[model samples]
Target chain A: MEQPILSIQNATKIFGGGFLSSSKPIVALDRFSLDVYESQSKIITIAGESGSGKTTLANMILGFTPCTEGKITFNGIDLNQMNGEQRSFYRQEVQAIFQDPYEVYNPFFRVAHIFDMITRHFKLARSKKEAQELIEEALNLVGMRGGEILEKYPHQLSGGQRQRVMVARAYMLRPKLIVADEPVSAVDASLRAMILDIMLRLRDTRHISFLYITHDLSTAYQISDLMYVLFQGTTVERGNTAKIIEDPRHPYVQELIDSIPVPNPKIKWNMNIKLPSEEVMRMKNTVGCRFYPRCPKRMDACTKAFPPMVKVSEEHEVACYLYQ
Target chain B: MAANEKILEVLDLHVQYFTPRGAVKAANAVNLYVKAGEIVGLVGESGCGKTTVAMAILQMVQPPGRIVKGEIRINGHNIVNLSEAELRKVRWRELALIPQGAMNSLNPVLRIREQMGDAIQAHEAISARDLKARVLSLLNDVGLPERVYNMYPHELSGGMKQRVCIAMAVALNPAIIIADEPTSALDVVVQRVVAQTLLDVKKRLGVSMIMIGHDMGLQAQMVDRVAVMYAGNMVEVGPVESIFAQPLHPYTQLLIESIPSIRERKPLKVTEGLTHDLRNPPTGCCFQFRCPRVEPRCLQAQPAMIEAGPEHLVSCIHYQAR
Candidate 1:
């Protein structure tokens, strides 16, 4: 494969975790690294619970937030050192789809205004006719017609329709990467498959890399090529989705997978759940392994220091003393 | 089935919402029942009237939305015909509702104990010491710490707040509890914990429950029987094992297949179109627009629920024609 199109090198983000703070600061992301190659389009998923720092990572990748340590590069160009022109170009190349489709647009404006603004700002088309043609083409790519969507307001469309319009706007820009944060969580389950299918088609036809962030392990396993499991603020496991989901080495990853309530009734769950104590969860000091309080298989060394990331295979990696 | 075994029953329940455009038939001839100490899962998409049916059960349907016709029998009393004063006594004491977004249902200014005490005092008179004991025991039952009784809603996490909601719903020992989307807003791990908490509370209190949610996986794990709804109509309902194993209704079959599975990777089976608009629903079947097995007869008249197997009922013309 060629050089990765986007690379996150040892990115560490600390919120108010600086010097001279009376309260304990939050370590949102700690020494996390990932790379997305543009050789062929693929999906990279970040999976975790509410406080696992997935959103923080998405914001950093979008350049809205900065990392305390390490760097993010696009096409071998450091994002932090980019000039104004370069930063604007980066914005055009990288787009995002947020969780709530209802809040994605301004309700007062017509839906087509969004596409018009994108084309005008990027200088993608010269005239009104050219911009209209471009908007229609992008809408068609997402299986929607222009006439049905152009003159309507945001409130008129359904949740699924609004989300597709957001996707169509991203398509209009011809971006190389799209970061979707729980895009289908608000939509009905019947429409989830369609949204996911559209995403898969985008990757295949457009050769556009996607940084899909969600807490749903099932959908991540279904569509992701690479998966990263985060606990607290650190990556506990990273590998091929099939291998990682089928044979999770990290204890937190295993629990997340097990808790996905299979649709089959025969596979009953063990009701005796082991939850982490609130004291260990709310502790301020950064001592040993962050998952030591909830890990089913804890070791003495795990408490002494954070475990080193070990290679399970050429593509699989885990951070735990047991794996070592 | 014996008369007393049926703790709650809704027969020919029709609820409509009169909008400026037209009268939306939110629920149409929906029939369901919950036996003593049994849990029934009501599964459907949004705008399918799952929540409307639940609201009708509690007699809390607001203006412009009324139960047009129905018999809601709870503990041998017809609640539909009861007076406001009579219904007030049966509201929380007989049928309790753990509403959607219940985590935020707690008052921000008051302590947790005050909220639970309000729920209990609204029904029956209890001494202050007894109320505290009851609140602590309910909190303990849901795996919450005793210290939470004094903390306000803002101090608790999302899962903790939901647990408090569950504790409040079952405080007065209601005969039936209706939990509408109880775990939809929670994380996956915390969702499972909350699901487990519901099961534990049900076992301890022996309260019949009607759980409304869109996730079939959680329903399969929790409910004793499953009821599938589409566009305000009951499509199919049966034992959980039987419904999941051999779903008769096409919509129900498609819904079960659409759920993504981590155990094995396969292409998801999605329904053809979006759910129908309630205001202008088709004259025949509620799911005819999205059903793959639609026929000429299906477009002419609605199919009645028929026994497909032992204790299994499905409302599809294809299944009924055979």
Candidate 2:
């Protein structure tokens, strides 16, 4: 079998823990693993609420932070052990799309400076004309015309247009994987569809796998192929997107799916449903299920230790003891 | 006031921002009303002037921007021409506001009790004991614990702080509360929780509300009526069910079609034209540049709001011709 393009094995990231400090260490991400194969390009969604460590996982994969344990390998090369040259290659192969498009650009420069910087750093083209061609082609991929946006300052473009330019910037790198963190959350409804459509088109045409990180499961359900539903930094459920959204098994996953406000007015949320306080929800259980405090179906067995992932179907796995 | 009585009415409102280049017509002849206890949603893209309209209602539009021509009536009293001192008397007691990014609205140094107390104390003459009781009850109404009263704003979570804002907005039981994107910043689960709190408070207090947001899904679930805005113009207004089920205006149709759904996956139907420059809007229709059903007549004159269905109003040349 061909090796996966990117593989993460038992990656753990714990923040602020040393011999000198008295405060307990916060486990941002605990033993998370995922794989993206080169043969098929896919949009894999890492979904969870705030502080569920979706961004932490993205940070580790993007080399923004190092894992406390385990390893992340890109095409069989461990990320931490990469030399300067290998690191550059990895950087080119992996790009990121942040949440706020407005803050990403420098206000002093024209929007074209983003593309010019990338091309200059990578030496993507030798001549000015060649560089222009590269930038135009990238813009075209995201359904934008370079002539309309290149000369304008960042403030001139709307939120949706700025985000599309960001997508074009990331695509220009020709990365194997794009880690998009809440790319569409800041845009409007119509433009959000456009950006998500661009991502779908990129996956099919460019063969670029995407690690889409978002708190919105509705959009994730629309585009992602595979999904990992995280609860307090632990993978509560992992499966095919359609399967998981259609038949979510874990208690936390079920609650999440139910909480999403459906667009149709005919479908209303159950108003009687109450969530636990933030204090209880954020309480960490070091030796047991993190969701135990808020889980309606929690039991004594759950508090004994963190449940292992058990296969519910060929492509679906859940970490609840009910499945055990 | 009676249930069907109009608690708040905005008629022929025009708000403009005078920039160095030109006057940006942020709200052009906008018209909307809220019946007692009704939750009317004002939704549009970022710069569609939804927030501007909310600020106009509160009489809070700052310099370079002003309510050029309009009449905002709360309980039959026009607030647009009211003096600063007169308006302050009408503000929290009659027409309150839960501003956008409400989590940051609270002073970080002040405890929730002191902050909420100040709003009440400014408008009323309650004793210290009575004020404390009133604040605690307000907190309880929003499902917040009593302990939250003494906690500083920084100590509360985002959801908690938002609930505090909601509690504060209802402190005086105002006739109408303008909530500007009340749940936009929170996570999905927490957003739903805050949304539910809003609904509960409205139902218990019988206060009318105007919710401003871009999230159609949340609007569908939370609001009684939905008003669609495009480029500083009111394009469509109808009951929430009818607006979602049978959107009339071209912009409304596109907006509804653009909302991504969780029930099933479908091809995204996005309209492709940028909103026209607000400073130099077209003569006939504000959405003519992007309207799929645009015609020459649409550019000849601005379409007036016509009755499209039972209690549904749409501003489009097609309906006007009919």
- Could you tell me the TM-score of candidate 2? 0.98
lDDT of 1 by residue, B241-282 (tens): 999999989888888889988888897655547677788887
Could you give candidate 2's per-residue lDDT for residues A145-264 as a string of tens digits?
Answer: 899999999999999999999999999999999999999989888889889999999999999999999999989999999999988789999989999999999998998889888888
- CAPRI-style grade of the A/B interface in model 2: medium
lDDT of 2 by residue, B1-322 (tens): 5678999999999999999999999999999999998999999999999999999999999889999998998888888988999989999999889999999999999999999999999999999999999999999999999999899998889999999999999999899999999998798878989999999999999999999998899999999999989989999999999999999898888888887888898877766778888999989988888888788888987788999898799998888667
Q: Which stretches of candidate 1 lie above 4 Å from their native place?
A: A17-20, B1-4
Instruction: Give the CA lDDT, 0 to 100, for residue A136 in model 1.
Output: 90
Query: How many pairs of residues collide in model 2?
Result: 0
Per-candidate count of clashing residue pairs (backbone under 3 Å): 0, 0
Provide fnat values for all models in the order shown: 0.76, 0.78
Error of 1 at B75 (Å): 1.2
Question: Which pairs of residues have clashing backbones in candidate 1?
Answer: none
Q: How big is the positional error of residue B175 in model 1, measured in Å on the Cα after superposition?
A: 0.5
- All models, DockQ values? 0.77, 0.78
